[model samples]
Target: MTESPLTIPIYDGSLVSVRSTGSSMTKAQLTTGLARRKAEPEPKWKSGELPSKYQCPSCSNYLRFPVQFEDCGHYVCSSCLPDIMRVASRCPTCQVPISKDKLVNDKTLQKDIQSLEVYCTNKDKGCDWDGTLRDFPVHFETCGFISVDCLNGCGAKFEKRFMNKHQKDDCPKRTVSCEFCKTSIIFEDEIPHLNVCTEFKIPCPNQCSTEEYPRGKMQDHLENDCTKQESPCPFNECGCEYRGHRPDIEKHMKEAPGIHLNMAGKTIALQKKLLQLYEERSNEQKNWIEILARKVNGLEKNYGAQYIWKIDHYSERLQEARSNKKTTLFSPPFSTSRHGYRLALSICLCGDGKAKGKNVSLFICICRGDYDSLLTWPFSHRVTFTLLDQCEDPDNRRHITYAVKPNVCKENRPFLGRPITDRNASFGAQKFTDLDAMSTLEYIKDDTIYIKVEIDNEEMVPI
Candidate 1:
């Protein structure tokens, strides 16, 4: 009903017979020239020339076949389809969405499109991909600059060609953590994530269990909801086993003699024995001084007046030494009534950490039950201590910690060690912070209670 899109041939009378462009020409002319033919027939005036076989717009293959498109007369026949559409489903000639109906059954187009060189759509955007129109759309989507993952850090790949979306986000190569906490998160965060996943719990301080949970629920788990609870008894081997809540054993130990008596402040009688030992040591020192004076006097009388006068002459010096030498004794103001629940004990001792015998001052801080009365050396002698059968692995063993040093411990430089003890010992951070409950932890590996020692630097001293 309308004019043909192509201009009519202009001719002069003098022998001018011309062949028309038929509205389509050099593929380049498909660009600028198409504008001049503004009135070209809708059915494509003389049906533009078919795609060549070499360029094979039909099958996108060199082999000729009856594939073609009605819109643009470009497509692959059913037989040539799989090879031409390798990675793309768009038409080879028209560059439209591939569909079963778009396929043309004209071998002429298959052989004709071969002569045309199709530029990939991405070529305008810097992609230099070149292929027959059939593979051009596919090539454009998979261009190297299309932003692919570098895996380790750079690069691109044909992602849509594969069923799986991608190993990574950008180009399928970066490293990423699991969005589900427990699922395998290949390279990048997944599209969506579930925070409440129970399998992906966090690491807990107790080192017991890990599970994924909300931050609020995490707090509840750490405080009280933990599924597992464990507490070991301090007495490792003596079989004075006790575990569980503090209130339970605190009441039980009050009645159990073997466990309780060994613990301090429970018995009225044991307290009395400690006071007696203090007195006995005092008496021994006094007796030794009198015996020494008597022997010196006897020697003076028997040896002769010279020796006796010599002793007599040195009597002034002897008096001075006696006056200066202070005798050591155990002393505490006697209070018949025991201090209730106060397990604090203080003591002074001469420690021998070095051969020269460095005189060092240190005090032990512990609890009443840290030491056993049955031990006799310290608990009964000092004010208080923590008792145990073993130092390590307290659940199965017994160990002890003395809150105070005994007066009689001479040159005994005790240390805080892995085994028996280490002189220059340090408690674990937890033990260090808890000054009060450290003795109870000695029920595990507690700090050491240092005893003072006396040393002589005479060996290195300059006269």
Candidate 2:
């Protein structure tokens, strides 16, 4: 069967077109009009079926809005009339020539067709309206079972009766007002707007006596108005330990002046004592640092078995020794090997023992070392000492040299044994070099003397 276009008014007061088939309507046909309104089922005729005379000849469907041909009294549905006139200019069944003026609306046949009783289109959907075809269109328009699109543009369809409820309560596009801020907004944006609303009331963050305040004023209230926030006492720097709410703390300050004064006095006394202790500790640390620095310097100097001692300010040292101010001057320490015995050279500028005021005294001392436990006890290495001539010409130089070997016996254990203290007692010649010999040659050139000492590694005792 051919389709017929039907125009209907929707709930939104707008007209939309829908296509109707002969007997039963489809969901697609209904939804295309933006209204899911079905067309009525076939009408119930007294004879059980529509008569053939009232059916269109071209499409074979019952004639709707039937038009009659004046020549043969033949009729076709108005929707199909245009096609017949355009194609053949004659009645489709009789072949009689027909024109637009001769084809007229058959009011009598229309009334007959309208008087046929039919069930409402929404009968399957629980609609009970049953009436003549003439009253069907009016009943369908107001049918509560018919689904229509929401007028709010929310893209929802339901019974025409529920449209009002959907728009007022469920449609996202419906207008709404914020309860707290009293601002108008669409239901779709209501949640997002409420989240950022400045006038929204929030509980006090500090948990003060005040129940709540607007979010916009919360910061100001916390900063200047909260009574439960804890603050330090006014005399906190004077060792006052009290902390309380502003009002309680103010009361404390007014009642505790004598206690605050006592606390101030004790705080000053404690500060003075702390300062004295700090000074003492600082001095001790400084001394320890100086000792560590000297040890580091000694380690740097004693990298090998040989050491070249440069004695500057020789005159001043000699004068100090002669006046009995300082008799001994110690050289930085030296090592027998990279990780072997630690030793140092000491010199008495004026002389000592039998050579007092006659010759300079020189001695060797064994110092405690990190590798002492790994070395052979009672030192046995031979040592050689040389006093550089400091001459401008190397060939013309007369350098004084001496060699010594430790006794390596129990009697010499005090001087040669593994050192128990920072350094063992000194041992060597008391009359090393005479004062007269120093005055001759270039031994004391530029008031600076260079002394070289070498520990013999050739016969070094293996650990």
Highest-scoring model, TM-score = 2
Cα RMSD for candidate 2? 29.7
Models 1 onward score TM values of 0.20, 0.38
Candidate-wise lDDT, in order: 0.36, 0.77
lDDT of candidate 2 over 1-463, digit per residue (tens): 2232332111222221222223333322221211121233344444556789877786665666666777798887655665566567788898988765554555567668878877776777787878888787688788898889988788998998788889888999999989988999999998788778888888887788658788888888865678877878978999888998889988999999999999989989999999999999999999999999989756644458788899999999999999999999999988887788899999998999889899988888999999999988888888888889999999999988888899988899999999999999999878889987888988997889998888876565546
TM-score, predicted candidate 2 vs. hidden true structure: 0.38
Residues 192-283, model 1: lDDT tens digits: 33344544546665555555555446667754545443343444233556764344545555667576445544344565887799789879
Cα deviation of 230 in candidate 1 (Å)?
A: 6.1
Best by lDDT: 2
Badly placed stretches (over 4 Å) of model 2 are: 1-50, 57-62, 88-90, 93-97, 206-210, 227-463
> Which stretches of model 1 miss by more than 4 angstroms?
1-60, 63-175, 178-232, 253-463
Scored by lDDT, model 1 comes in at: 0.36
